[model samples]
Target: MQTAAAVTQKKLKRNVSLAFFAAAVVFSLWYINFSFSEFIGGIPIFMNFLFTDFLPPKASDLPTYFGPVLDTLAYGVVATVLASVIGLVFGFLMARQTTPHPVIRTVMRGFISLLRNIPFLVWASILVVIFGVGSMPGIFSLILFGSGFLARVYAEAIEEIDSHATEALDAMGAGYLQKIKHAIIPQFVPGYISWTLFMFELSIRASAILGLVGAGGIGSQIKLTMDLFQYNRTSTVICILIVMILVIEFMTKRIRERLI
Candidate 1:
């Protein structure tokens, strides 16, 4: 089915693409002043620093982190719940199949885009400035970012639902609310739960670091320890964070497996 000229053209295009990719790699390396020798030499230095500075974490400081850890979990839980509710509403508005109007959908899409484009840490920093350093700012930041992300994904999930049920509802002259409740909700619930769980995991990580910006949570402990040149305590906080994340991830995975 292929002509000789067509095959030749395809080969030429492939070669050109490869050449451009190679050139881009070379340009990036030069632009960054990349040095293979320095990169190789840095590994041992990094290892030494890690072992000397971060090893043998201070176990005694664990008791002091209880309140901060709880605050971090609270921030993540509240943010994720609020974000999921907001996302559900906006998701329906943004999806083509469920949208009330094209203009509304476009507006919502733009708003969500704006929220999602701004980094979560940046949101925390800005909010902290407005509200002053506290859990409220960190929680609000996570909610804003999570809502944007979930709204986009939820819209996609809604759009991907089987059309047969919706079509039947339409044929029966069902109202928008009726159609959504009877058709969309059933299909969307599983994916919504899964995505929300993923968002919660991300929120936990984000909340942990929000303290670096004076937003509040266990991350503030990290910042304080680092500021005091207490690497041992810093390592302890980091380990706790790691353990918390791992436990959350494991729980989420199990929940998804059972529910989704």
Candidate 2:
């Protein structure tokens, strides 16, 4: 029967896909220099840092570290807000809905890719040198990162929207701004909000690391404690960061569920 033949073909295709995937996995491991000894060698250093350098967290310096935590939070919030706003405008420009120019879309997409390709640390490092050790570099780096990501997602969301609705709006002679404000925004509000929260969650983690170059967060606190050989305080800071991350994760999950 034709059904039997089709089923056999599907099975054959599946087997071929599995073979390719299995080969790729083997090739990846071989190419990457993966070794058990490499992992074993790194374990002890981590153990030493954990057991000797970071045990019995000291709570004495809580007051001193408080300011830096607030600074980091402020940096993340400011950067996220700025990124979302800029992304809104740029996303409109980047979306082919308004422009419909292939060249512009390609350029915008390429720029977004470029922004995401560089590691944030590398961008933060360069920014620190140009701006000099502070929250400004951290915030700016996040803005660049967030704007690029949001612009692409926003463009895709716009493009995927119902054409009939857009057509109806066009028949009414609605201006581009009005059409976008009335039609596009309402349709995409849920997705936009979800992504914005997602970005904030990422910002929370990035904010912590951004302080490494003196961007002013718990990272700076960790650096300071390490410099002073205060492993106890460092442990406390680490614990606090872990809790903050968990709390943010929980909050984001709840918000996302509610939005849905």
Candidate 3:
């Protein structure tokens, strides 16, 4: 009887805690001036803006946008390629059995962590200051972010693999390179490719935003159009970006399925 009473009390306490949390969220929304009534009231204004400013999507500007679109694609591709290569090397070093030294592993891991934790926008903004507002800054930002991300993924993938092949090679007096070539490479290649493909998708999206900071791409075009109140052109650019992403995603998805 005593235990039953305690259980009831615990459930009531939990329910009360959840009720307070819900109330707090409601209060926060009110404090921030977030109201469904306001949104409903603004619908007519939103529709006016949409029809007056965003319709017919600046189709004539599509030709001029080609260069920036290509630049975005190039940034994503080059950064992903470079980052994958660098990340693969570092990832091997991060693995327990593969690292040349424990100290080196620790340092390499710390560097990868730093790269991944820092936002690409922050990287691009800083690089733009140094590189003077070009695709170079955008590419470098993607490279840094992609390398860190790929290295972490690759390292984890490496750690989870069956060690029997590598162990046999080691027992047969195989050198590190030989073991990597004969055993580790075969097993890790699929995951490496899959991760790299995923990173390419991420890099494309990230590179688009890099242009907002003057690191050239379609984002720069969008920013320019918005500054001039050309939301129609901005909408067109976004449409192209959406199509590009969809195509890339489709291609990468097929490739990943095949590889994995």
Candidate 4:
């Protein structure tokens, strides 16, 4: 279906794109000072360490981790609940169809952007510095980051809803709250639940990592064990963490399937 010139042009474009991609990869390797020999040399050393130091996890430490595991779950649950509420409010404000004023929407959008752009660990670290290392900082960090992320996604979901219903409400002289209550809420609930569950999973992982900075969770135990060079204990904690994450993931998937 193509002329010879068109086919040649297509091949030229493909070749150019490949050339650029290869150049970029080469530039990146050079920029990072990557060494093929060093990378090859490290493989056996890494395997040796994995087998000699980190193998055969100390399952004896499992019972001791129960409380910390509970704390991690609590942090995630609390943060997800709080963030969902906050995100709902902001999402309504950010949605162009639902916003009361353009200026308010702009301000809320900027605020949400600020919150979402910062890494969760960075947020945890900052809060730990301000509030003194504890669970509060980690929880607050999850809340902040989750709120931003959920608000953005919620706003997008709201925006994607069929506009005809709201437009009809507008034509019927419906109040803003009436339209939101009758139309937006009904449409948004499923997405809200799904996104909230996803956020909870992320919050759990973040909370665990936050503990490394003394924000308080199972990760604190990990840091302690690693500090003591108790690699076996560290391995045990990691195994527990892996199990917890897998369980949460399974539950979340099941819940999403049922609810959404």
In order, what is each prediction's RMSD in angstroms?
1.8, 3.6, 2.3, 1.9
Candidate 4 — which residues are off by over 4 angstroms?
1-10
Residue 241's lDDT within candidate 2 is: 83
lDDT by residue (tens digit), candidate 4, 41-105: 99999999888898889877678999999999988899999999999999999999999999999
Per-candidate TM-score against the hidden true structure:
0.92, 0.81, 0.90, 0.92
Best prediction by lDDT: 1
Instruction: Give me the runs in candidate 3 sitting further than 4 Å from their true place.
Output: 1-6, 9-13
Error at 21, model 3, angstroms = 2.5
lDDT of 2 by residue, 74-159 (tens): 77788778888987776777777765577887887788879877877788899999999977888888888888887777777777
lDDT of 1 by residue, 1-260 (tens): 99999999999999999999999999999999999999999999989978998788999868999999998998889999999999989999999999999999999999999999999999988999899987889999999999999999999999999999999999999999999999999999999989999999998898667989988899999898999989989999999999999999999999999997
What digit string (tens of lDDT, one per residue) describes model 3 on residues 34-72? 989989999999999888998769898689988888888
Model 3 per-residue lDDT at 18 = 100
lDDT of 1: 0.93
Give all candidates' CA lDDT scores: 0.93, 0.82, 0.89, 0.92
In TM-score terms, candidate 4 sits at 0.92
CA lDDT, candidate 1, residue 151: 97
Candidate 3 similarity to native, TM-score: 0.90
